[model samples]
Target: MKKIAIISALLPLAAGLCGAAGKKPADDAVARANGIAFKFYAAEAQKPGNVFFSPYSMYTAFAMAYEGAAGSTAKEIASVFSFPAKTKDLRAGLGAIKKDLERAAKDAEFVQANSFWAQKDFKFLPAYLKTLRSAYGADAMQADFLGKTEAARRGINAWTENKTRGKIRELFPQGSLDQLTRLVLVNAVYFKGRWKAPFKKEMTSEADFTLDGGTKTRVHMMAAPGTREAEYGETGELQAVRLPYAGGGLSMLVLLPKEGRTLADLERSFSPEKLEEIRKGLFNQKVKVFLPRFKFSSGYKLNGALAGLGMPEAFTDKADFSGMEKGKRLYIQTAFHKAFVEVSEEGTEAAAATGVAMGLKSMVMDFAVFRADRPFMFFIEDPKSGLVLFMGRMQNPAAQ
Candidate 1:
């Protein structure tokens, strides 16, 4: 597992560093919390294959502790991870991640691989929860925290099954979850909307889609007419485009290889910063949106990724969580995250009725064209906390 390497690298540093004299536990806590969040996104981006994980849920739990312990050492702990003494504006840093999120969300094939990993990791949840409570104090934990944890776990499982159209079950199997786990908080968000404008199943025709190599394979390409926010740029020799979400709060970003360049070359040049720039510069423009009707799922084990990002002490059994409770043995054994998303022409619908009506008549015009043909990334974030509630990548839409 990738986590093994992270632990190996940080064990030495964790042992050497003692609690700074009169150091506030809150500061360390926040640092640890934010470190974990940052690592999830960073690792997902660095991993060779399609990647997806939820840093939002993880942050929500940590945020609960930060809020509950406000003015105490816990607040400082949250700040460490959140503010990162060295950074000026954490929001700016997060905003820059729009591209990566967009890529992960839109890529169908990547989503499938990610969901497989998430389901596999669900098997170890029982032992994982035990380790959490043992390290953090029972008093420091809240009843709501437990409830949310359970709900989030179940919600993800349901989403996984739904996204897979019932092909997979028990994304997190029974007997895997625990009630007494020392969890911080739970953050869950589910999005199941059809495309604003449904494609005429007949319009979908097989076409050649360029892959990583020079080979061109036939894929079912879904074309539509719509107004989408996008940007044109030349990062080295590749051509790229950015697709913003409804409110412009987040976006789906794609990098297409220049005529002669291969997808591999574009992938090689991809970076968090470049992705950010693409998002920042996006403007509403009229264009032909061609994509594939694909579906996929993804799962991730974040323990190692987080540790490698400079949060070593929390994962080890010897780690100190006294601030949460004096003399309590607390260490994070495993951090598991999973997500599922589908983008089609079929959107969501709601209806309301009034007791008194005058010749009631209603007309609804719900039309949108979102064709996700190539690999793309996406994220659902809490605008206030800058917390990423859900994140995923899809490379295939046909699976849906």
Candidate 2:
């Protein structure tokens, strides 16, 4: 997906529910979180084969930990997440957004869950727990990471699978957790929705798709009628459209670059400001929509990427999460993210799970010709709420 997608999802935080607690941040923290994620994804991680991930999931995971951060560590995380410097405002804002998301999820086949797995008998500050539960809807579970590490891993994985309807499985690779692991915080997001205007299965046909390196392959391009006055726009080199789901709250946005341009070319200049302009540029229009049917899963080990985003202290001995516990006993060792996405004639299905294992350790728019026959970016989000559940690019549907 275009790096801009991450920034867009953050907009929801800025647009709080009508009756949410306190006033929302004037500077838009969610946008800042998305920006940090893109900086890391573009420069450090994002691989080519149909990239799919939930910036929401990763950011929420870190956010839970941020509640427990202190000193410069807290300052750095606040900067990274665009959190209000005042703790109470941060809680009120996120708690309000969480309530809005819960209400929206109840109206659709959507689920976003957060859980905290702590070593048995490890004493964590109660205030930290309270904030996580109240602001993020996180549940705390005691696990024997100090003893039955494998079993703890299995339990966490089971929670993810059940929450995501099995689309995500075995979130933590074997050996990801062990005796030294003190706390594991995880967030899982799942979404299944039908298109408001479904594409005809019979209209799908073989079409040529070009990859970044000039490689071309045949792909299953699906088509739907285009006189619907959909949300769409185009620039000289790029086209974008927003394809809404059945509920109207969520939509899939596709970004297609012109023949001579590449997704990388569009990405290089994608910043929060430019992203706001593109979003504002969307207008109702009519055009044929042809999208390739593709499904893929991506997994990332995030130590390097998080460091690249300027929170290197969290992974080192210099870390301080004292607000969570005494003696500064925890530092993130590794962070893992796994996501799955599929789009076809009927609709879209996406799920993502993100976890951080501590050694005390720690860590788009739419349419025009919008024909995604070439390398392109895509993202699924709630326009009203500004929540981006999934984002990725189908650079080469046939790659893996």
Candidate 3:
């Protein structure tokens, strides 16, 4: 199967906020949800692999479900997602933030989509539908989950594939959705940006990449000559670099851990506050940088991981999605997420999509010389909305 991932670990250490008062609440909500997400990753350190995800995708998909959640179900979802106490505020903040993000992506093909699917004949509450349409830009569509489950699955997969520019397909997989499925809230985001200071293709050459286990791997190292001033930052354990795209509105931030320190080590101690410190302290300097050419896709089964974040009620029979329908019979059965990213001398092409079976539950700047020759953490974001479009760590750049 292709690489599809559930996004919960994208921004364990992202530290930036929205400037507008209206968007601050939404940013705060995502920030808190990030806390739970990274914590879940730390708790599941036993799983072996590099971290990759789109937390924004997961947050928005869940927010769609949270709108219809009532009583403890709503409370649990809010607590898990770190939403503000009031629903009105959450909606307003999210709306402002969404509009700002949509506006800030002129430089990149940053497309975001949301949708709601319910079994045919299910009477969805008007207020719930309105919340999805108004606050999340989603329209509830009736599907015959009981009579045409496979067709419904293919339709959803097709929608996700189209929205993601064919980057994410087969998100639900065979039999993942069934006749018992009541509702699914979907989110898709696509981003492709060319670096303002593109690396010359001729400069890419063979280099040795050191893996965490002390294994050496041959990879294509991309070099950028030290001519133009670059923004950079470094502390005891990390070196950071900011590469602006064709338009200055969006950029990619690469965080390389110092020698002898592993990306896993930084992840264990990382936080939004620490990321902020790095962003604030960067300086402009002349430096030679080497980044490996990497391309890979990732997918995850998030049911267990999300349950670790608290809010198991949303996944089980106890889920209360009454805001969606009169009876408290709907619950989330499964959730799926897939992400794709490619980094070359030209620029970066990344896309991510999320699906929530609500059947019922569940950036920076600095100046300094930076070389990302080793495994490192990176994020592509639009600072205006304080939303991370893609976040992942590269272990073996040679691996596709």
Candidate lDDT values, in order = 0.37, 0.70, 0.71
How are the candidates ranked when ordered by lDDT, highest leading?
3, 2, 1
Quote the RMSD, in angstroms, for model 3: 5.4
Q: What is the lDDT of residue 261 in candidate 2?
A: 93
User: How do these models rank on TM-score, best leading?
Assistant: 3, 2, 1
The candidate that wins on TM-score is: 3
**Candidate 1: which stretches are off by over 4 Å?**
1-42, 45-48, 62-184, 193-201, 215-218, 225-251, 262-272, 347-400
Candidate 2 TM-score, C-alpha based? 0.88
Model 2, 1-400: lDDT tens digits are 3121111100000000321355454125455445554565576324545566787777778777777778887787676666667777766655656665666555468787888887778777888777767677777778887679899889988988888788777778797777778778888888888888889998899999987788789999999655566888778878888998886777887778877998888888876566556667888877678888887777777777767667788777788888778778777767778888778898988888888776654203243366788988777765655555566777777654
lDDT tens digits by residue: candidate 1, 1-400:
1110010000000110013466333323323333444446555655544444444334433332222221223334344345333222332333233233334334221111111111212122343233323322112112221345466445544544444344333444343334333432222323332332344566668876644443455677766545443443434454444444443443334455445654445445555445445545544444456665544445444456545655544555444434333333333434444444444444211110000000000101232233334444544332222334344444333333
Query: In candidate 3, what are the lDDT values of residues 173-273, reduced to their tens digit?
Result: 89787767767678887778898889988989998888878998898888876555667878888888878788777788889998889988898888777
Model 3 regions more than 4 Å off: 1-17, 20-37, 40-46, 360-369
| Superposition error at 24 for model 2 (Å) | 4.0
